[model samples]
Target: MMEREARRTPPELQELTEQLSLRWFGRPFIHEAVYNPRLRTTGGRYMLRDHSIQVNPAVEMMYGEEELIGVLKHELCHYHLHLEGRGYKHGDSDFRELLRKTGSPRFCKPLQAEQQRTVRHYRCADCGRQYERRRRVDTSRYRCGKCRGKLQEVQ
Candidate 1:
């Protein structure tokens, strides 16, 4: 995977976060920015507990620096706003204004890992109801929601 090929050192991410914070927000980033491989969809996350940021390594490896920077900016918005005791979440007016002012993305682009998912189809034996799911469903342990009928996989 690209995530394995182009892994960034923690210091590099931290430095970038600090630089962007200072340049744009006019404040120092006192917390850490570490790569977390377990992040599946979102590019980065700001921890409320320690005021730290966790970035997905796959973002830099798969997309590049521009995408990484956008993620950083988004997370930094959360960090700085939270520190200032302002609205920091996506739905907040302060967060929205900050994103627009900084030209930061409101949301991260969907990850490639999520695009190639295969949908599994199933049908209820008695009701003829159909269902689609991202994962395989065990018929023995599950039933159709509508009519409480046995579900059978449909090819």
Candidate 2:
């Protein structure tokens, strides 16, 4: 993945933020916007401490720039409204309305590369054979591929 500075919203995010801010909030985003690698399990977040937006780098690395722009818009909604002293929280009415008005997505998909994606573990019910797979195996029909015994999950 690119460094967080390189990931700074990109040229597309910059343009999208400029347009969205003008259309939805009647202002411009003047602060630095960049991805923070430490953020896990979230699409984006606005830093109240600096008024900067920290987007999860996983978004671009996994979903591409188009989806990342949507997240940018979402964060910008918080940025603009907060700077103006309007209700800017996720549960606030103003925030919700601004999100809808800007056509921003509420959630983003988890990047498969971000963590362990799948695990299938089983053990034999009959002979105590254990099995582990990335894909699930049929418990009713398929037995331990090695011992031909019933399989159960071990871990």
Candidate 3:
């Protein structure tokens, strides 16, 4: 059996989140804020049950402090609005208005590493058509769409 190591939440992260809460939303953050290393795609997420905020540590490491702050602000918007019985979801009008009022970003910038992912290339044996995919495809199971030719991986 393998045990996963626990990652400690930095004290400064809590302090920064609290400060941003008061500075931007003019309200105190009474909940916890921690860095979650398991977050792969999203910059941050606000938990409705615990009212806590989980920030992806990679956002700061990959994009820097400015991007991190933007993520925090965006999450903070959801925090304040939800607590006040207002719209907190991205599709809600109140959420959009608050985002505009707070000057928080609507979307976080894509991580640099995510943009540099290697793409797999494939070609059809008969049609000579090419395709690019992020994940590998089974040549035996899949075939060309146009010419119904067998697909061969390229490099």
> Which candidate wins on lDDT?
1
Report the alpha-carbon TM-score of model 2 versus the true structure.
0.63
Clashing residue pairs in all predictions, respectively, total 0, 5, 0
Backbone clashes in model 1, listed as residue pairs: none
Consecutive 10-residue window with the lowest summed lDDT within model 2: 1-10
Model 2 pairs in collision:
122-152, 122-153, 123-151, 123-152, 124-129
Which sequence of candidate numbers ranks them by lDDT, best first?
A: 1, 3, 2
- Model 1 per-residue lDDT tens digits across residues 41-127: 889999999999999888888878888999999999999999999999999999999999999998887888888799999999999
- Which stretches of candidate 2 lie above 4 Å from their native place? 1-16, 113-154
Name the lDDT of candidate 3: 0.89
User: What Cα-based lDDT does every candidate model obtain?
Assistant: 0.91, 0.77, 0.89
Which segments of model 3 are wrong by more than 4 Å?
1-9
Q: List all candidate RMSDs to the true structure.
A: 1.9, 7.9, 5.5
**Model 1 weakest lDDT span, ten residues long:** 1-10
TM-score of each: 0.92, 0.63, 0.84
